[model samples]
Target: MIKAQGLRKTFTTRSRKGTQTVEAVRGVDLQVGKGEIFGVLGPNGAGKTTTIRMLATLIAPDAGQAVIADHDLLKEPAAVRRKLGYVSQAGGVEDIMSARAQIMMAARIHGVADPKRAADDVLKRFDLTEMADRPGRTLSGGQKRRVSIALGLVHDPPLLFLDEPTTGLDPQNRANLWDRIKQLRESGTSVLLSTHYLDEADVLCDRLVIVDHGQIVAEGTPAELKRGVSGDVITLRVDGLETAAETLKPFAREIRVDEDVLRVYVDDGEHTLPALLRTLEERGIRLSSIALDRCTLDDVFLAHTGRSLRDTGADA
Candidate 1:
């Protein structure tokens, strides 16, 4: 379980334009319930990782208050570390270290009663027993990732912090990791996952917060956030954008103009599409394309941020 308020972090970076102050996390408020998979969903530079790092005690927040697993974040960092497992985006593997060796070292660091038993148990759990003796460089991407997670779990902590855990894995590997994460929740381990993948967040998180520009724009269950969009989406590509938007206004709850698309939100898209088409015809609007789709998390994002998550480069 985790709770934090107004957590902030900033950095100075030197670019061609010279040194500039960057507020990676302006002020983020987060909460994760016990036995649940909570997600921080956002774009690449949206500060999800910065927030997670703060909560995991890997980085100190510029200003905020937090309690991770009942330990004060600022005052009891060591205690917090003992209560949580942190698997960073890097996969935390050494090229020369064997999977079994890495896990045993982790167990030993955590002071497990039996290091070999702990390592062996995790290797078997993650199905890495076959490659347990192989060095990290010899393992496949999926195997290396699974071994990283196994290392995190060797100590059997109650909470886990996963930062972009599946960023580079293939679909099969991502699915495998997802199943394992879901199992962790079922087994009563709380997880805080930071990801830019919409499908991953939608499928894995019990509740999630959407962040953009270093701020949380929305927070709710996936279904709840999608429901907040309040209607189906009808996307259209017409020659006369503004005129088409005006003509379709009465029939639409809202309209968002993208570069080549006009997304019209309406409660009755099927019925309204005909009227919209008729109105467009009367207005002499040349319709290039049209489509109807159920509202999605992306739509929710568009409503709150005036930009699609896809457009924001959240996809892998």
Candidate 2:
């Protein structure tokens, strides 16, 4: 229920030398189908949060156009705001208010006639009912995060923008929140979430767009993206890059050697392993460990962006 075309945002700041402009988002094109859970994956400072802010009507784009829930973001931002529920990267709820109070207050501000019922419904569905009376300031980080989620969802808007929805929670709490997000989508809420966790995006998103340097580097289902990498990955713990590189040259489709390991990409690791072992044995290259597995999102990212998400230095 969301579409953005040629979206761009730039920020200007004064430096000691002169003013410099930073392009946070550049010509980004995004589409989220109705009732679909779409994910934006990137490392910190990749403009994921900036894109979300622009979509949520919290920030205006420097260029391009967007239609959120059939309302133009630039032309009819008020309507867009009415249709979207935003959970920002920074916390949104009050510290001292209880979860129930926070949600109820949000509903009232959003013009919901029955704030109590709205608050109760969200609390029950999000599994915050037992903790409704607990003060947000006194709650655990996960609980406070849940309260923020509840506040966003209290109005039951058709479109939701969640930035790092499960960033700081424990595994169990993260799983619990995932179930609730799934339920929201099943009930026909369109969600667009931005996250750094590849495993979370793999499990929770129907499709994803990978962003880097404020631009989309790749977009696909997790499986499709993984399969785009052309071979199996073999991790070999062999000392001496020069020796391993020489020994592995004939058997590997591509060879990348670090200080004490050689990563080989090949069409057939199972068959290639024997040849690789024979070459290593013939050359007397000592091997400590060998592992073969299919490529992952990290590999796909490296292929596209020449950098891992973990290495991207994104602060957000």
Most TM-score-accurate candidate: 1
Q: What is the C-alpha lDDT profile of model 2 across 92-143, one tens digit per residue?
A: 8687878898899999999999999999998887778998998887887777
Predicted candidate 1 versus true structure: per-residue lDDT over 201-282, tens digit per residue: 9999999999998999999999999878866899999997887888888987788898789999999788887888888888
Each prediction's Cα RMSD? 1.6, 2.3
Q: Using lDDT as the measure, which candidate wins?
A: 1
lDDT of each: 0.91, 0.85
List candidate 1 stretches off by more than 4 Å.
Answer: 14-17
* Model 2 lDDT on a 0 to 1 scale: 0.85
What is the alpha-carbon lDDT of model 1 when measured against the actual structure?
0.91
Return the TM-score for candidate 1, rounded to 2 decimals: 0.95
